[model samples]
Target: MRQVGGIIFIIILMAVMFLMDWYVYQAVKTLLPDNNLVVGKIIYWTFAAGIGLWIGFTFFTIMREGHISTRSQLSLNLFLTLFVTQLTVIIFLFGEDIFRTLNAVYQYLTSTDTGKAASLPSRRKFVSQIAISIAAIPFTGFVYGIFKGKYDFRTIRKTVYFKDLPEAFDGFTITQISDIHAGSFTDYDAVKRGAGLAAAQGSDLFVFTGDLVNHKADEIDPMMDSFAQIKAPYGQFSILGNHDYGDYTSWPSREAKQKNFQSLKEKHKKLGYELLLDESRLIEKDGQTIRLLGVENWGVGFHAKGDLEKSLRDVGQNEFKILLSHDPSHWDEQVKKHPKNIHLTLSGHTHGMQFGIETPVIRWSPAQYRYPNWAGLAEEAGKFLYVNRGFGFHAFSGRVGIWPEITVIELRKA
Candidate 1:
């Protein structure tokens, strides 16, 4: 909203648009037939105009109000995503054209023939055609991700064996989800169905590894009833993620941000989750107890409010502990280093960046670059961490290769 920032943003967006338009024209103008070219031009210009209008709307709105709400957030996120993917396509096609140009330059300089003119090489129609075809694959997939992939909830069942697990709790089961980012969810029925599926797992304990909302507490207010359906005898436990503190959005004042944080904590309670804020709880059976500890938001470079020492303050060193810290980076950087043995840690702040390839043969996501233990389970000498990909989408509005996830982990004593 600031004038200088707005002007800079406008300049950058204009430059990007100009380059994109040029590349798009050069890449596909010649391939379409005359009839199709007419339609394509209409489509192209309409799309370009839409982007321009969206940019104006977003900038002006933010300039006037100094911030954006859900409506503007949604529009802006969509526009940026479209811009990035289109830019990628443009870069690829431009690289192809540059190669052709260099070859043409070489041909002109090297030729020795007389009279025959050395005409600059024309773009290969076939190559342009292939470029577009290849680009369309990802474009179509991204469109589908926005429409369908985000809501396609898939439950992942995993069994982990632990030699130090208590014999009494050997067969304990936990259903874990993370990064609800409730602000971005659209369909109630679809979300409810996901919650239903998690409940249907019938685990002894249900846990959410943080990120209950995007930037504010009210995001989850409407969906309390649906989430409350998930219950376990031991109860539902949750920890805070970086986003839960309302740090990503602009607020009227520090007091407002604090109030928003309080409301988010209350939302967790209302949803039947015993929100663990740098605290510990004991899950006891007959004469045995396993410590369930949780900390506030902690990440290597993010909002690191989670206090591992405080959370484990009075707990005994020998107790079999299950710690819930939002970011896996916390586990890698801090939890694993402590002398007190933490048998298991559950986290999910990465969300796999909402895109990646995951299979038995290969598990990969851009998130892995930032957080080594970005998804699934990572193990050290005797400690383990399970990073739930995420339960909901965030800024991008939808997921792609990394669809929304529900994880069911059954624990067994080795």
Candidate 2:
């Protein structure tokens, strides 16, 4: 029964895709010279065929395996991204053909050769050229995003002043990164460079807000050395994110899933990070002490395993506290209102959708509509939340305007 349903779904999807491909073909035919039409046909058919193959493979996995692995899932994501982005650009080109078609119909009805009559001005030659010219901008941007932008890691530094901060920790610095998504990385040197940059900062402390791997624990094994490069005298601390639970991929049994998670925790250990699961640690400098709390993945609608209250049970009210919760929504739903008075919260799950615009004056991403605190820093009352854009890309395999981020936050006494 499932096989029958899957076949029917694939057929319907292929039909819709073919119709869309026809429109793209028609748009290109109108502008290209006769000699160029063969080339255009080749380009259109090749892309259309690739999409059809991926759709079939995706349906097959859903029926047989129940869930696709992170690598195959990302292939589907990249295919759709190229399909939709190019589809948008060509839709404008199709509009020009619509006007040309209307003009042709007008010309045939008027029969201007035998009558001294004015006909609707024929579509100008430059109109088709202009449409094609404009379509190139998005095409170029997508190419750059896939090849260059994803690896363009940048460090963002913010100095946060606190009037009530203890003087002993006033000049302390903390480094943070989130959403490693190690399974999605394809380039070794680029990945090493980013990790090397984070380690070079030599901050007083380092924290990794999670999503360490996309699905499997083994993904980080090959790159363990690069991540281990990160060093701080205070040591590194980490928490899990939505992807860490092996929820996105199929497992043989419940026991297998549990085992995978245990292995993932061990991977963090290999990377020199102290895996903090619903816990708090006290870091002392001179005679002053501050609390560092970490909780498991907690988001508005995701795996809400994080226990903020349990982690803070041992913490005192007077001590300055930094909480590492994987998702920013935790701040909106729990962290901010908690009576513990968490001074700082670090999170990263949105990844700014791995594409967006950020500048000194303006910051924006489609991810913001779903997560108000999608990127950078935001404060409410006296509490702070810093969303670390992300340390790695995931399904789409690239970043656009919002590149990978390594966040350095400095604490100062006001």
Best by TM-score: 1
RMSD of each: 2.9, 4.1
- lDDT by residue for model 2 (71-172), tens: 565665555555655576467756765776777667777775765553444444465456556656655665687788889999999999888888999989
Query: TM per model?
Result: 0.89, 0.85
Model 1 C-alpha lDDT per residue in residues 7-102, reported as the tens digit of each score: 788778767776777677777677878779889887887887787777667766766665455577667666756665667667677777778778
lDDT at position 213, candidate 1: 89
Provide the lDDT at 255 for model 1.
98
Clash totals for all candidate models: 0, 0
Q: What's the lDDT for residue 8 in model 1? A: 82
